[model samples]
Target: MISGFKLDWTLISPVYCKLRWYGLQFGVLTSFACTCLAAIDQYMCTNARLEWGQWSTADVAHRLIIIMTITCLLHGVPYLIYFNLVRAPIAGEISCTSDNLAFRQYHTYGYLIILADAPLIMTCIFGLLAHNNVHQLAHRTVPLVNVL
Candidate 1:
């Protein structure tokens, strides 16, 4: 009976660990993406050029919504495919794990690319651009009084 209990514990531990690990991964990725996107939107709204045309706030919001939706879907599909619970060898026990090693690797790489690398690069690029624009604007002198 004691050995059976130990076997049950061994079988259950992996499932719990996988659940916590993947849960943290998903949570961190989602939150990071959201925060970065929001910061990007805020920076763009304040510093964007409207030389050709003007965009309404609603239009900008819609575009952002579409972008976020696409990003989530792209990141989510691989996770859905590879992350799942499987029946363990022990009867009535299950384990949470990746369904495919290749898919899991792909998902990890994709997460790093989409959630970490891309966002960092974009934020830095846009931040520099916005800073430059603001600096140039501040330095430009406007005539306060008309010279006859």
Candidate 2:
């Protein structure tokens, strides 16, 4: 909202620029990770194997979420270090960009793969696995008869 008013905090402060990009990546990655974790949790819970079902407990879910949160935060640290406000000579336009050339390239390509496609693929895989597991529940120790 502040940015909508043309009072961009990132433009005013370098620290804000760093933190803005860092927080953006952190939030995006964390959301995707959590969603992937949920899909895996569903697969675990639906598995016919008792050992796999045991891992679907609330405690395990909490731990996994925490681990993912920390991992995403760590992954975003590079954005904090690399992203900065760069001045363009053509029109004196300032843009938020990465300082390192390699990191910039990675941000473009790697972000698409790591932050976009990977999670969707993981979610689809585990979702299908869970569906298959549900179908096999009828063969487990506790019988699950198909509904008419």
Candidate 3:
């Protein structure tokens, strides 16, 4: 959230002339993706039973970190290329903006996919799976009756 605030501020701040759009994009996407990965991890952990072949939380976390890093790097390339601080003709003020129209549209679509679509879908899927797993586990457990 703080990264998001910084990105928002950088876009609007008049005094902030230079913007590292790649870093900003990478940070934002990585943060959000990692958050979703964490939710998936929680669901997996909750559903895991005492099995020998099951993956450990540490293993899962490490894999997720690697995946998130690679994804962020891949997605951040366009921001690195197209985003720059330019002076507006009418206002004579500098602001962060994209250079190429086509690339900008592609980048916008990428953001929508990564930030909105993927997260929402993943969250719902994991949440429902976790709920069902918990319900099933609860039903399978035998309730002890106390007889005095």
Number of the predicted model whose lDDT against the real structure is largest: 2
TM-scores vs. true structure, each candidate? 0.59, 0.87, 0.70
* Candidate 2: pairs in clash: none
Candidate 3 per-residue lDDT, tens place, 8-124, comes to 655565233234667777788888787787667657766847552155368767987998799788877766566777678999976677768897787778667877888889888
RMSD of 1: 6.9
Per-candidate Cα lDDT values, in order, are 0.61, 0.87, 0.71
Model 1 — which ten-residue stretch has the worst lDDT?
139-148
Candidate 2 TM-score over all chains jointly:
0.87
- Cα lDDT tens digits, model 1, 1-148, are 3376544432355544454555566667666666666656646555647631244266776787678656665555555556667675668656666778887686668657866787788778767766776675565534323332
| True-vs-predicted CA distance for residue 71, candidate 1, Å | 3.9
lDDT comparing candidate 2 with the true structure: 0.87
**Residue 110's lDDT in candidate 1:** 66
Q: Which residue pairs collide in model 1, if any?
A: none
Which stretches in model 2 have alpha-carbon errors above 4 Å? 1-4, 138-148
Model 3 lDDT, residue 101, Cα: 87
Residue ranges of candidate 1 with Cα displaced over 4 Å: 1-49, 86-95, 142-148
